[model samples]
Target: MSQANPPGRPLLASALGGLGLLAGMVLIAEGGRRLPPDPPSIAPAQGADHLKAASHAPLHDARPGRSARKVAADLIAPPPLDPSGIERTEPRPPLGELGLAPRPKTPMPRDWRETLLFRPVATSSAVFEAMGRTVAISGTVDIDPDRTCTFDNTDWSCGQRARAAFNAWLRGRALKCFLPPDADRFAIAAPCALGKQDVGAWLVSNGWAMAAPTGIYGKAEMAARNARMGIFGPPQ
Candidate 1:
């Protein structure tokens, strides 16, 4: 046998269902109202150095070989900061009553050029001290072997004429200038005898004008045409 629900109890259950649905809607609306407004975003502070470094691509650090050029460039454009921040120590004077040791002054590093030539931190022990932008060489050639040289001198003094031929050979180049070695400083290696006369003759034949020929061999060589042609003054 099937039993039916009481009419009064069925009506009460329907009313409770409607109230639950309405209460859920109200709770949802109330929750939406309490949401706060969107917050602002904070940006990071950036340094100019970062942007500058990023702008340039990588470059080989040629700090050792081209020191002069490097120093000159540095003097023009200062570095972002001093790599080494150590302060230089000042020298102290003698104490009036109790004499004390004077503090030694620390030597400052040379600019790029000095560092290149003087402070060459390299394997080869070659130290060069030069003034300004040029290197000066002053030394006597070993005269023992320099005195006599055997050469083959035909119509063209192979030794002297050879030099002029050398100059002409250099002239053949597209370079701005080329200097032939002076007979005195640099002698021709020939199969026959070479004298002062042979040298002067070579200069004349090779389109080189003769300066007043001094009897001295050394003087004559000094008058030779510039090795690099017009690059530098006449040969020393």
Candidate 2:
């Protein structure tokens, strides 16, 4: 039919629109066939072609197990620095012993009259030495022969008792506990020079004072009697 149309409109509007729709469909089908099949998709295609992949993955669980391997590998090894390699030295004799006075030059002298207390409790000397690096021990430990020691009313050898007590006291502690002799140490004390009795007895009977690594003397008696402990100061 020759349909009359308005001045503003084209006559076969419906037919033309239909034809355009058919062309679009044909183009789409053709292009799809011409394109390569999509690479195996792990996700959805975009614009009907490209696809999206998983944003989340399955989490793996850590095995809860105890094994010898874990224990062996977990251990940390200790660092080594040989201390014996370092050269060491013995302490110089204290100046107070100008010739062998048996005591340092201190103003404080031993008070053999009960001003001090003597209660010797034995412990590992090595342990004490290791803990307090600066600590030292000095006493009448090295008295010469002829010095009489009485134990239970019998004469016991001075040297024998000193050696035994000294040795045993240091037994059973760490090897590092004992310090090498001759370390330049400050005698907070010096050895005691007991004339008649043993160190224990003398110390008790004459209440004396001694420094850490120096001498032991009757400090209480000296101070009271104004006896000269000599140059350094009273035995600390």
Best lDDT goes to which candidate? 2
Model 2 C-alpha lDDT per residue in residues 126-174, reported as the tens digit of each score: 1123333332234422332233444345564543343334445434333
Tens digit of per-residue lDDT, candidate 1, span 1-236: 89988879988999999999998898797985655779854344555665677789666666776433355776799668775985888877776735854545434234211112222111111111111212111111111211222323212222333333433433322211111223224322211112222423333333232233332233333434334221112221
TM-score of each: 0.14, 0.19
Per-candidate clashes come to: 15, 35
Model 1 Cα shift for residue 220 (angstroms): 99
Q: Model 2 — TM-score against the truth?
A: 0.19
**Model 2 worst lDDT run, 10 consecutive residues:** 112-121
Residue 11 lDDT, candidate 2, scale 0-100? 48
Top candidate by TM-score: 2
